[model samples]
Target: MSRVFEKRYALSRRALLRSVGGLGALTAMPLLSHEAFAQPVFRVYPFQLGVAAGDPQPDGFVIWTRLAPEPLDLGYGMPSEPVEVKWEVAADAGFRTVARSGTAVARPELGHSVHVEVAGLEPARPYWYRFTAGKERSLYGRARTTPLAGTDLQRVRFGVAGCQHYEQGYFTAYRKLAAEPDLDFVFCYGDYIYEYRGERLANGGTGPIETIRQHNEGEIYSLDDYRRRYAQYKMDADLQAAHAAAAWFTTWDDHEIDNNWVGDIDQDGTPAEVFRLRRQAAAQAYFENMPLRARSFPIGPSVQLYRRASYGRLLDLNLLDTRQYRTDQPCGDEWAATCAGVAAREAQVLGAAQEKWLLDSLSGSRARWKVLAQQIMMMDLDRAPGKAVGYNLDSWAGYAQPRDRLLRQIRDRRIENAIVITGDEHQNFAGELHLTGATPGPRPIASEFVVTSISSGGNGQDQRPDMIEIQRANPQLKFNNAQRGYMICDVTPERWESEFKVLDKVSDREGALSTRTKLAVAADDARVVSA
Candidate 1:
């Protein structure tokens, strides 16, 4: 049958689906032919990979799901046909009162994934949602719209985490995060899954990181590999629980496509054309797996990820896309370089366009807190302890000109309460952003808290020796912790506070999560203060 005919093969319920009651009444709809509503050629639950929702506005949010019956199979054990998926949002979990409901086509071309943007609902209210594909019902998900864009709000809470390597350990930190009922949303800062082909990595210098599970086989070059990998991660109960507990806001760094990849360039040195194909495949899988809004829908290796999420009058979040527009690491990734190559002014992280967008957003924001939810460490951390300093070129420290430009804009524009939430260092840090990049006694233009990874590295210590050295050399630094877990931010009208929540260990499931330290920055002041 033709593509259009195959689409028409679905149960005829256009008029029935326009009403809320018709959604639940769809249980009896059947395929006209055996090939109409195709199923995987195996015994597996279609919703094994789980469901999620993200990018919530005051009126709506996006709900996501993929039909992966046999998750690891080359075809993800899903038939090569479109399936009808119905989603209903209710004010309560019991489905007694449906607020908004709709049906979406889970197409084979998009890996059988569904993204339904539920709209016209009440603002700042909690809603429960679930999907039904044929007879299989997905786990219900909890989501909330942001407060009306201009409402005078007092407080908001959220958790930030990323860099979860599947083999490193279990997602116990996510379990801890899922239990936090007060969180408005979760901010995932890149490296959600590693693309390595099961290469054994030493967790830290010389020490072997304990493994809980390993990757399927080789490096993921095709769509199937990435899909299988994502399905494997979603199958974890902790991650699923996290998704079920609240909505999520996410952005990608190096590992989503390839390590240290900038723009169209892949780190493995594949030709740009071939790498673009790989990138497109990776993006397809990412969109298939992530609970992102339609604005970030992938199209031939590109996706518009940088957008604003406003939460009433209390906060406006400018989620950035660091990897997509960044310059390749000046002196190669993950190394210290003091050469002139690092000093060149042409290096751009946000490209020219996104930088403008950010500055404009910052200037126009009327909220009490302006938060930049981005990836990477923004401080100029010196790796060398002497007069001639060496810096890591992989982070914002490498793109000094742009970093300085951004800080200057923050200062010149007088952006108040400009707080940056970050990750990808695998270690916690509380620091200030200074124009001169001198840590000691320099008044900060802005403040940032770099949240660590969930399980990217193995268990870490309370502090690293080099961090102490760096701290001594730089006084703007306030707190540092090397551990596995997430960071929680409490944003109020008058002040913003962050708790460095830590897991004692990720190498084993027994590690307890604790608040290692707390820090605060007043709304009027740009300096980080210990709470």
Candidate 2:
């Protein structure tokens, strides 16, 4: 639900291996082509990776699938030619009332993927869809369109999450989310797949720096590698179930391409030109796998992201691309006793263009709540607890002026009820947004809720040692939980309620979920409080 799309627009990492192996046989069969569009094809199911819907507009949404009879293989066992993939949307799960139907070509360049942008239908309603190629048919997908723009609504329910390192743990959080019958949509804020070849790792400190499984190949630099990595991640039943359950608005973070990568700086010290190629491959694979429109598909190294989606007059969600345009982390990308260049005026995190766009949009917003769905923490989190401020340069704290500029826009325009829902740090955080990039200062102007990972960091405790330090260091923050899970938001005209949904364990598939706590932010007060 980021980029603009018309009806025709078109449209990981781990232990993952054992889990993926259970998906089915990796055996593949012979080729099928559009010339043989009428011929029966595929010995194995072509929709092995599953179906998903995204970029939902008022009138329609984009439904997607890939023809991968042998999912793990580079070619995915599809012929090197155009394949005609047909899709249909209906009013019932049984598809009794067919609403619209069309055909799309799965090109070889795009790894034989299908993206169907469906339109000319009712808004704010449920529709079921399926894809067909030859005699093989895909599982049905369910999608819901947004309400008409400017139309007032009673409520909105959604989930926010990301950072699922397959090898690190199971996707049980996604399973729980999918089962939630009340959710309207889900915002996936990146780290969709880890780029590192599955290398088994072990705990090095307090962080989830280890993995039970490793990447099958070394550092992925080719389009095929990216596609395969994505395929591997997609094999998870829980993840696929969530995709089928509700519409998703997704954006990328560091691991989707490379860890903590900024612009051409891949953090791995790859040259800008070399990293550009990798980025290009990663971007292309991302587009092919995602339920995005042709409007957002990549052209070489760049893809159009950072767009707005409105849920009637109740909410305006702005999905942002922070890693694509940001400058390298100031004073090196690490937590230090002090980072010197953090306050430089010219340093950009959102870049001048996106900054202007965000500021202008926030200033002009007429909705009750403006939520920024993005990667990385926007709140200034102190790495070292003390009176002398120490900051993590990898976040908004590194690009000081730009953050201040946006905060100033809010403070100046009185952009009431603007909140940021973020993902990255594998821990949940609820805080009041203050202009001071460093927290525990000034009056609250906006609010931020950083959702924990789906799995990435492995199973954690009810509390971590740093929680007390962080809370004491930054009073603006109201909550912190180092667990494996996500957050649920139930928004209404008067109050926005949040529940920190946590999982007792994510080391395997046998975990159960419970709410750690619930928070509420009154519409006008813009302060996080106990619900």
Candidate 3:
């Protein structure tokens, strides 16, 4: 049996909504001083959005929640003045022994969200937490700190999931993951919420796909719009349960702001200056909703998301921000066989500074496994069926020079057991990473595992039409599954195993999960073999 906490945190999204809807608006209550610490009365339950904790350190982590009785509204029905929120962490799920308690201000400017940075706790242990705003108490949440910097562990496990478009299907993946016991943490690699206002083509294709549900309004632009969008996603019981289950380490991809957006460049050709403002709004909402530390707080349109998380001396997890600093996609961001722009030397994915930082971190780290938790595929995938060799301009294949440079450094530095877990591209993939144009390339330097979407596509097939041909074309590709689910990774000092847990269908709430495939890599080898 997994050595997990006996108590579990569970809640239903609809029940909270139904119960809170009966309460009237906050306007029905009296005004309060901005600086007053006194509890103010809320017309509805202020903790309807649920509670979350993330960014775990050996000694501490950050806990988060928002005062949103009315989640869909632009203002969230929050009062104009700041509200004081109280937080408490306990050794037991029942709160019989409180470990730490503090107060935080949920300012109206930040959509009345509370972020409490907690410390002075034991390392590598489960802690239960909750928040209080006025008379309402939040759902109980569980968080765990990492092992000490140099401590060694026998094993580690985590889930990789993202790209959940609310309109596509249900978030049964999250619900299942929440039930998983003894997970160290969850890594949401990107596309936490799709920015599409309504049903859109499955990648600018011929026809618009039908939606199981729909967004509340048109395309989001303002801060309130982004906040409401996040609220809609957070309101899901499964997503909330997943947040409450354990601490999450999150990083974003294109859809969080706009589809295929690179820095200030919008896919629809929106002016860079105008898009910057939208990005600012998106960034702020992202900061407010996520269980992130102060290091990732948004400043205008910029947020520092690239950081390293260590789990003892066994793994060094590097969370990357690929969308925020990337150059505009090459060849108009389309699939092409032989475009000159695809190999442009100036094109960058991680940019110079971030590239240097990643390289330095990987080289300097002493951990047995160096895991790159990021968005977008780093493998050079040729999508064309036959020998045409088309590549996605939005992926690393478009920026060949930079990708080759990074791979060369990894090979030269001999960074053993390097693995990359990626989101985006609503399909599952397991492949070996090799230099693009090497003459009969040597052994792979690293490995990559791409997890499929939580619910981006409606119901996905077990196999795609061109999957076999594409695999034949690229021998480095080991496996591909077009399904809706996530990856559960089990790591040890000697090897790493990735279990591709997929859903039969995500169109409804009754989809069942099963292991589609399992792949493993040895400590010093990059070859991906069936487990």
Candidate 4:
């Protein structure tokens, strides 16, 4: 569907759907055969993969469900043809007041997945949704629209979480996230699934970690492989519950395709041409599973995942694609001292176009808070604990010049309340941001809150000796924790409060969650402090 038609349809849908209730079943599109209108019979429940909603706008949000009668089977245990799936939106949980009802075709080309860009919803309100295929019914889901553009919001709450390796541990953190009652949305930072077959050495440095479970037979590369991998992850009940509980704002990092992949360059040095094919498959599989809008559909190896979402005059969320447009990681992409490559003027993390877009958006945004919901830590952290200085070349520290330029621009442009939420570190960090080359003396221009992994690092400790040494070395860091958990942020007009919710263990299914730390940044100040 073209954008022009979509807008027109959305404008008219509000009135059309008002009279649609109890008006009998709508006919299927004429392009299909008579059998398209017939009810399907399923041996297994088709909605085993569950339901989800994401990328909410003021008027509506996207609702998604894949028809997988047997998710583990090849082809998702569905016919190699299109199937009509029924969907409904209601104002109440019991679906007493139907808001919209329609039929969507689940096409085989997209692995029988359904992505319906629901429109005509009331702004800043909650809506209940569900799906039906034949005699099977999907689990009910709740989605909400943001406030109208420029609407003054007093407060908003959300969660930041990512990095769930299926083999490492159970998705207990996700279950905790799903139970958050007042979240407006969940910003999923990345590493939704690990590409490796099973538990491997942490960053290929630490010794091989034990696994509570196991991934499929091999590392995924082909389209079928990627699809099956996503199916396996989505089959988790905890993950499914999180998706159903709230709308999601998602973007992928390195593990979505390959570990430490740089643009078209694969980590193992696969040729760009060959790796592009792998990236194509990975991108398609990502879109098929994500509740993204039509505009984010993959074209070859590229998808426009860098976009902006505004929540009235309160927040401007710029979800960035750091992995897709980045130059190769400098200094061999490992923990090392800053090298000449790190200072190269040509090095890019957001690329030329994306960086310009981000700067321009930040400059023009009228929102009270400007958020960069992205992958990778932006703060230049010294990873080494002692006399020898080291940094992760895959992070912003790898491109020191670029990092300095971005921070300098933030300072020069006077972008107030600039906050960054990052993923992929598997360890929580609350840090103050400064120019990499600056002679820093507590003059931070921004703040960053890095959420830990969902279950990637197994059962992590509350604190480690090495981490203590590192934290002592970097005084700019306000707090750090090595645990499996996520972060919850509560934003108001005056202050932004962040709470680190940590789990004792993810290797086991039952562990209590606790708040490890709580920090806040005043609207006029960039430093993070105890709340």
Candidate 5:
């Protein structure tokens, strides 16, 4: 069966607010007529999922949204029809006077996603924005630019979250994060969407626990499959609310396609060439659904996912790409010398281009703090100290050479106040990073705070005995908690504090949230102190 016809797909009632009469038909709809346009029934796009602004510079930030009207193809098909989208940024919530306003068009070729890179704005100031298409308008989204160079920012609060498996539970975590009005923005560290065909639980189940759309009848190996999955995930209300609540900076990890997939390797060691078409499809869908700049658009099986963002004089965040340019998975006994060899100098995690970019950016950065916004833990997370190896070899530990080199650069160049915010493992961890083999041997060079997952594995799972033993052996690891929640990081000129907030219960949809732990790093020292 054809991909499109695999399911009797129909746009939801909420998606039909904007008629399918093309731009002309939109005007004819009672809700989109001239009078309606004058007083538009401003409703956010349901499947646009989330609204986010990112890559904030002194001048501007990119605002994004996807149009999901009926006859779904009308919004993403070729010919690239122009759909007028009006956007405004304001100092206040009511939009009494606009700070910035412009007209943009959502082109069909890019899945009708609109990316408005607004400029001519003041730095270190908060702004509220919204978008309108015909009679349909998105919710007000908040974003801000980095402060001016050398300006003292007393505080910067941001939310960190990842691994939101839609079927596991509702995006209640996001709902709570959105309610926190003090947040400047959100940092999503990958696994935003899982590519599994259905929920695979410890107890055998053949379908998703909860889903907006049916899963792919089989494994997703096509662009259409990925696109449809994105659409399904976006239909979640909580995810949409969070996106509307704040601007987001994002990166992707393995589940965006398959677990542990690097470059083009299959579970059976099949070359990426065999799955080239599927990989291309996944990359394209990822680009269409993300609030990424044009430069990161997918060309084929690859997309440039690494870049830098500045937060005024306070911080420079370098988001890394650990998937695309990585070496193959390691081989040998889980904890043997053979496995360690796989992490040799030839092994790579950041790829050549990304490594050079990261090194140069870190060395040249003038911000008070250099933040590495990466997908996995940067600290050494050996499941077993000297004997047992970790279960997964796709993380930084697997690319030991690249990890050491990056840490060496930070130490050699005297990159002060370096910090890494990461996500991926379904656990929260706080650690002080030390460059073991550098000239300044075994000295603390950076700090890393890893956020837990959203709803991948519930919070009630029994603790793993191996992990418990591993923690007892690794003194560098300050804190560890297996839970379902997010992290909140507050940065300032004097200190950066992080709180590991966990949901009271992931088994229940309306769970409460509490702080699992807290860690702080002082600007004068690169060490992590308990808060």
Candidate 6:
């Protein structure tokens, strides 16, 4: 049997402390009045957004929750005193015998959110945790720590989703995913929250119906607006439930700030300085709200979004940052003066530093599968012959020189079990990456799996004829489908399976999900096959 499925954690109480005595008790005395302490303690906001864990490592994982006095943020404008939150780990769902317990203060600066990274936990073992503040008690969340590095793990299962536009319909898809008992964790590729308003998209779309208060204060461009937007998205009961269900590894694409905007630039053509400030604000809000490590925090307009995560010897995920540093979009013929002068080789999608990191990581990885969790398609999908014209110039195809260089590295290094998982195209595609094309200089190298959006562009109902024509023109394309839903990727030592899980309908508010397609990659060949 595979160690991935058979792993277990032994429960043993390492430490325990209550507010009655100890350092936390002594610290809590001055902050709270006698009357406040006298009242019966209640875990009122036990787990406002449900218990969530993320950024897991072999030694530990981050456990999180928000302490809300009220169901919404109405009760307190801003919590003056730091709230002492308690957390525990157990071997079973019910904390019959607590293993570890600690106190963490929920600072008002972060809207009373508490994130506890419990270290020294046994690897590849399932554990349950919860948080408590006063009379309120949060729901118990289950999380599994990563297996020891290079362990011979056999199988791992996870769900990959993106572009969950709130106004389109209910989060029925997430509700369904939450109920699924098998997923180890959730990988939100991007567009977790659409920055646009309901009226902005031609319909009365409210963008995923959630309990969190909506951002009634116009389009979000500043730090405050971004914070409100995140709070609104987090309020969705289904989304909260899903978070409670498993840990999440996430990254952001353009919609998190502005659609299709490149480095330090604004989509509406705002001044460079003004746009850079906006980017900084948005980045700050993102860091504050997300369950990210301190390392991902924004430094000026840039956040280090690209990094690697491992799952024993089974898989290694290299999350890519595609939008942060890149040249502006290529202009049309009418604006040739602006586009023609731009140097294609000097232009890049991953930038120099990130690209170098990726190359180095790929060369040294020992996992059975090396997966690239990226934002856009890596395989070239040209819109016109000898001309760049598909999707947008922001994708890999737009920066041809860099794309070729990357492919050449893969070929030269002979990096085995390399796979690319992408989002942002609003369509599902399977392409056999030939590093060297017939007209090109070098030889063939990689493979790519581009997942369709959860709900974007109104379910991609209007298919582009040019896209279909282009597919026919390109022989490397194995599969293509424009749909609304996500992908469920199952990895094993022998093979990797990517199931295109699609919703029955997106136009209707209440619709079921189904597997529209399935593609598999054999361990030996690393080639995709229709299941």
Using all chains and alpha carbons, the TM-scores for the candidates as numbered come to: 0.91, 0.91, 0.91, 0.92, 0.84, 0.84
- State the displacement of the C-alpha of residue 35, model 2, in Å, after optimal TM-score superposition: 8.4
lDDT of 4 by residue, 1-531 (tens): 211111111221112222112221122222322222446767677887899999999988989999887676677787665566889999999999999888777766788788887888899999999998777799899998999998999989999999999987899899999999889999999999888875443432365555678886589899988988999999999999999999999999988899999789988989899999999999989988998887788889998899998988989999999998899987777675767898899889999999999999999999999999999999887887666778888999888878989998999988889999998889999989988845446668999999999998778888777889888878788899989999999999899999999999987999789999999999979989999
Candidate 3: where are CA atoms >4 Å away?
A: 1-35, 200-210, 439-442
**Model-by-model lDDT, in order?**
0.82, 0.81, 0.84, 0.85, 0.71, 0.70
Considering only N, C-alpha and C atoms within 3 Å, which residue pairs clash in candidate 4?
none
How far does residue 34 in candidate 6 sit from its true spot (Å)? Answer: 16
Q: Give the clashing pairs for model 2.
A: 11-115, 11-116, 14-167, 15-167, 197-215, 198-214, 198-215, 199-214
lDDT of 6 by residue, 1-531 (tens): 211111123211111122223322211122322222111143243354566777778767778776553433432232344456778888788899676777666654555566666777888887888877655577787777888987998888988878877665556667767777678778888888778753433533655433222334467787767766776677777777777777788899988888887887767788989998988888876766666665675778888889999998889999899888777766531221224423366768888999999999999899888888989777765556335434345577666677778888887898988889999888888877765344322233667888877667555543466668777867677788776777888888988899987776666657677877789888747566786
Query: What is the alpha-carbon lDDT of model 6 when measured against the actual structure?
Result: 0.70
What is the overall TM-score of model 2 with all chains considered together?
A: 0.91
Location of the lowest summed lDDT over 10 successive residues in candidate 3: 1-10
TM-score of 5: 0.84
Q: How far off is model 1, as Cα RMSD?
A: 4.9
The model with the greater lDDT, 1 or 3, is 3
Off by over 4 Å in 6: 1-47, 68-77, 200-215, 332-343, 384-391, 435-444, 460-466, 507-509
Whole-model alpha-carbon lDDT for candidate 5:
0.71
Instruction: Return whichever of 5 and 6 wins on lDDT.
Output: 5
**If ranked by lDDT, best first, what sequence of candidates would result?**
4, 3, 1, 2, 5, 6
Q: Which segments of model 5 are wrong by more than 4 Å?
A: 1-50, 70-82, 200-217, 332-340, 385-391, 435-442, 460-464
In lDDT terms, how accurate is model 4?
A: 0.85
| Candidate 3 residue 21 C-alpha distance from true site, Å | 37
Model 2 lDDT vs. the true structure?
0.81
Using lDDT as the yardstick, the better of models 2 and 5 is 2
Candidate 1 residues 286-315, lDDT tens each? 988898766677878988889999998899
